[model samples]
Target: MKRREAIKNLMLFTGGTILFSAGLLAGCNSPAGRTFISKQDIYFLDEIGETIIPTTARCGGAKAAKIGLYMKMMVNKCITNEERLIFLEGLKKIEDAAIEKYRVEFLSMNSDQKKELFLNIQLEAEKYKKDNKSKPSAPVHYFQLLKDLIVKGYFTSEIGATEARRYEAIPTRYIGCINYKKGDRVWATS
Candidate 1:
């Protein structure tokens, strides 16, 4: 190769390498690289999920279904950045509310206390929605978001589908008419 051509190619290669290296270094410091969900946060979420779907004699609950981890994944990947921020802030708010109301942390509260707390929060969310006249397109209250995530994660989990609800791997025969019972668990799939 000609000397001039060789120098030009070397410059191009060096420039490309420098750009790639800078990008890699920048990524290490990016917001995405930080750990937003700590272990404590995950445990808190698990407790919240368990409260939402307590384990019954017949089936496992949200914690057993790993609903907290599912919520984390969904919040990180599926939701918008604003929604994620709201959810993270809501966690702290829940703790604060618990402390103010019961003089104890949310995780330290008993099942009945937790249920009452959740019910109160649900009422507050409803009142907020009603007062604000929020449109359907607008974002919902963080508690609503959390409740939705918990329910979605739990019902979609393997334990929920198979144990909490009736699960039939294959329907051997289709019965058009079947007896209905008032307290029957709904079928997850037909």
Candidate 2:
């Protein structure tokens, strides 16, 4: 459990490997009474994920990679029951926050509104971390989780691999330091 917790925190901060959670591979073998992410949640999650990694001049973002579907698999399979609930509650929190801010649901928000909402959640998470600085095992806010998963899922997805980052199956000889370009995509060695 400590290892899993550590991995979760690590991903939350640094965005670890793709959605290969043990639960994902474990199939429907989670302990009985476990609640899974519902279909309705996926739509909001996609919106959030897209907000986290919006398409830009470079390439399409998490939505192009279908990150919400990947997140669903990760949460249902790999995430612990506790974290799973946190994730779902996080969705509800997003909706509630949206309503409070715009008098509309999160899904009803325009792109700019969504971005602003995400920024507010990020601020809240930072405040949460500061207030719980002494607690080593303090859990992160769900927005943090959403951001982490967006990065992981995006970078590992097909579009992320071939477009967002440079991916070559077979490489020529390693050319040691070429002149670096400012807008160059990072190499996907994995």
Candidate 3:
């Protein structure tokens, strides 16, 4: 009887452990959960994103709210495997080009230098498209990918929703559209 009781308790413990482990794995793979992004990559992304959408005192900054993590999550969940790889490669190429052309890392480049580099890359992508008039455009371009990631990250963040759009998670039951005057604040629902 003692041996039987010990075995039963062990089985229950094993079952509980398995369930806990499964939950932990599921959390890691969850769409809402943060994705894995390198520290250097996140820093670069944050700097770029902040430049695109400057954060004021009222609005939170991209890095403060983990917009880079959101971007990574979106890329992981929404983008195809090929596109995902291409987007990551494009980011690396942007850094490589900055270093090669200006002798400085992308994040290390001055605002004007960064802007010029981005514009040059954009022009090159346009020329590439024109050159390949007969062929379908490439799956992704470096400039476009960077812009898309920055915009997507910014708009989806709390600051974007709350400050940029003035979104409110919980709004009152009654909303009077006609009563609202020009320049009046608009409330948004998620």
Candidate 4:
């Protein structure tokens, strides 16, 4: 091939590659690629998720795990539109309930206060569940949704897998059902 022709072909290939990569990155970062959560909602979610799973010295918390981002992505990409709306509205209601009950934001409360508030919410949610007794209930069952999201988001994060649960990524081989004596820390696996 002529040197000039080769140079032109190389430039074309480089340009195409750059464009392809840019497209891929855009798709990966798009809201459509994740949960369709708004930025304002994410701010509240971050605060709430951080409270549910606080960052510790040994293990990264929900914020470090980007649980809010994960929740948003899951809601947007996986959940139904109705569910997404309900969950979003549920979060707002939770905040409002906190303000009405304790005169403070849920995130602003101390650990004990947060726990107490959540306990009451949980009781109320349970009562609602018992009264309703229906499957695929509104995601606004408040405490149930919060608990589910917290557990789901935290455990799915890399920090949760590695530090919180002490999971190893490589070496996929596993031994089934090891014997353990009483009073040992339980293994962390789904």
Candidate 5:
């Protein structure tokens, strides 16, 4: 090929490649048929997390740690598309189940009712997990995913580390062997 023709061909190919990549990126950013995580959804997830890890006299629970936002971030970024669908669907199912059972939305229900609903859903998730155990490619139970996210987010948050668990901001020395106590809280650093 002539030198001028070769340079022109290379430039054309590079331009086309850049345009294709830009198009793909733009398509990804466009939320076509995508279900957005609304403020209500965040509140719902917060309620679920609070039910899973209720506030106690010692410290604040998952809700105080803002676990709903954490779950949303993880679902959007860390999980696969299929898992995200399942998680969102599970939220709807929980809402539906509440309405079916009590004729009331989950947020309106009392704490005891919330706890009961969570237990029932947890049982259902366990059953589903058992039924799908034989399938090698089966997805994880949505409740399990929710639970994991809540625990992880809560424990790692500042409130959880300092209030729920004993946190040492600066340790002078390591205790290789410490005396054991029954009701002592675990160290966050440990």
Candidate 6:
């Protein structure tokens, strides 16, 4: 019957359309050319964080908290595709700058040299902000993101919670007034 043929054709067309659409959607979930950072890059991130907050006599730096892994995880999970590209670019820029100026990779540079390189990048970012006409809503520098992640990862880490600041697991009483010193480790639990 003509009616039966039309119904069968309609069902087949609908099923094909659904399958095609589903396949397209699945392909779109992954960003095009999304960079996959390796262990070496992770080490670079750790060294970068370490340069920013090097190990002092009292406490350990970002490397102690494994800030590089934190940064990589956050980048892969939290940021958009565009942001990921920007991050990768900024990372390469840092490495390029370091190699050009210090004759070494950022991770291989000494703390002082690393500091100078970061300062240079900061200056360049400032110059970019001043020169650019439009104020875009996305991140302009990777160093800022790196620093933020380092701080967040470090503070939330066991070393930061236990060594850097006093961790009060159980609070018997809340001190309303406390004497302040010129230099003191603030209560992290507070």
Q: lDDT of all predictions, in order shown?
A: 0.84, 0.81, 0.71, 0.74, 0.84, 0.78
lDDT of 2 at 13: 62
Clash count, one per candidate: 0, 0, 0, 4, 0, 0
- Angstrom error of the Cα, residue 42, model 3: value is 1.3
The residue-by-residue lDDT of candidate 1 on 57-156, one tens digit each, is: 9889999998878987888689876677678778878999999999999999999999999899999999988977857666678999999999888888
lDDT of 6 by residue, 74-157 (tens): 887787666666787778878889899989877778888988888888787777767663767645567666667778888888
The segments of candidate 3 whose C-alpha lies over 4 angstroms from its true place after superposition are: 1-37, 56-58, 127-137, 173-189
RMSD of each: 6.3, 12.5, 7.4, 7.8, 6.2, 7.2
Better of 3 and 6 by TM-score: 6
Off by over 4 Å in 4: 1-36, 134-140, 181-190
- Tell me how far candidate 5 lies from the true structure as C-alpha RMSD in angstroms: 6.2
Of the two candidates 2 and 6, the one with more favorable TM-score, higher being better, is 2
lDDT per residue (tens digit) for residues 20-126 in model 2: 45446444443432367767777777888888888877788788888889999998888776677677678778889999999998888999999888888899999
User: Total backbone clashes of model 2?
Assistant: 0
Looking at model 1, residue 12 earns an lDDT score of 99
Sort every candidate by TM-score, greatest first.
Answer: 5, 2, 1, 6, 4, 3
Query: Which candidate model has the greater lDDT, 1 or 2?
Result: 1
TM-scores of all predicted structures: 0.77, 0.77, 0.63, 0.68, 0.78, 0.74
Which of the two candidates, 4 or 5, achieves a greater lDDT against the reference? 5
Candidate 2 ranges beyond 4 A from true positions: 1-34
In model 3, the clashing pairs are none
